[model samples]
Target: MANPDFEDLVETFEFLDDWEDRYRHVIDMGKAMPPLEEALKVPATKVDGCASQVWLVPKIADNVFTFRGESDAMIVRGLIAVLSALYNDQPVSDVMKIDAAAELGRLGLNDHLSAQRSNGLRAMVERIRETAAAAA
Candidate 1:
């Protein structure tokens, strides 16, 4: 099952008629996220394989998983927001069980994103899964 917040995002994507509008909505979602602390953007948090600079900081509390991330590019930042919705506040077990590729595909992102972006997204998902597995 997807996060309730992610389900809301899917609903919003469905409401938008055009890709341009949906793209803007994604950017708006990124704008709505709080900026990650500069100190937290260190090497350990940095996600490799992305064309733009990206960092993800994960936190697990009592078996619930959560993360915050940032990217140098706006679109990438928006992508991070989308990932946050997909994975945040989930139980560690549930986090590992999520099919991120399928969930993102529901938004038609797989068809629209560039190859580089797709790879980067995959990298982020891998990192999240690894973190969750470690916690579990």
Candidate 2:
């Protein structure tokens, strides 16, 4: 399935006035993701330093980088959904061009997250960038 549109995700979050509701929405998004294939799960693809287990696999086709990710925690899975919407099916350069922190803020997610969760998110993004850089 195609990743949800970023704007649509932001709008959906906006509809939830309360943080609790928004969080549930996020978790639901995570649950909505299809499971990653077993073959793609590997140590090298795993995202380190996450509070919960997370694996990220990057694919480059026609110069665009598409990401597939999975997480053990529901909240983390939701976080992956957000990241996927931003980075999936985009060129490596385009993914690198995005200011994820600012974009998350615009989506009203940055301030709501705990420091640990924020750090994990940063780590995930950095890993993706590193993967892209290596591919480049």
Candidate 3:
């Protein structure tokens, strides 16, 4: 599936016209994520501070960095999908350089999230960056 751009997410939010619809869209996006491989499932790959169980794995292929993530909760899986849309298939440096919070704000996601969820999202991003840095 094609990754959604920041503008695409924003436009989706605008088109939805309600938080419920937006949430459903997010869940749908999460449903699209490929299942996390059994080998990649480990405590070390798990993201901290999230309300849901989230795992992230980064790999380099053909010189491009790609991330794979999973969450037991549908909403958190959707959150991973959003992050994947922005960071997957980019170089490690590019992924680290991204200002996820600001980007989410521009996508109208930051404003809608609860404080805990926002913090969890930030933690997820940080974990991804740390993984990328290690890989680099």
Q: For each candidate, what is the lDDT?
A: 0.94, 0.85, 0.82
Clashing residue pairs, backbone N/CA/C < 3 A, model 1: none
Name the best candidate (by lDDT): 1
* Model 3, runs deviating above 4 Å: 1-4
For model 1, the stretches where C-alpha displacement exceeds 4 angstroms are none
Would you estimate the TM-scores of all the predictions?
0.98, 0.91, 0.87
Ranking by TM-score: 1, 2, 3
lDDT of 3 by residue, 32-112 (tens): 989998888899888889988889987887757788899898988999988887788887667767777777776677778
Q: After superposition, how far is residue 9 of candidate 1 from its true place, in Å?
A: 0.5
Residue 80 displacement (Å), model 1: 0.8
Q: List where candidate 2 sits over 4 angstroms from the true fold.
A: 1-4
Candidates 1 and 3: which is better by TM-score?
A: 1
- How does residue 62 of candidate 3 score in lDDT? 72
Model 1: per-residue lDDT, tens digit, 1-117? 899999999999999998999999999888888999999999999999998999999999999999999998888899999999999989999998899999999899998899999
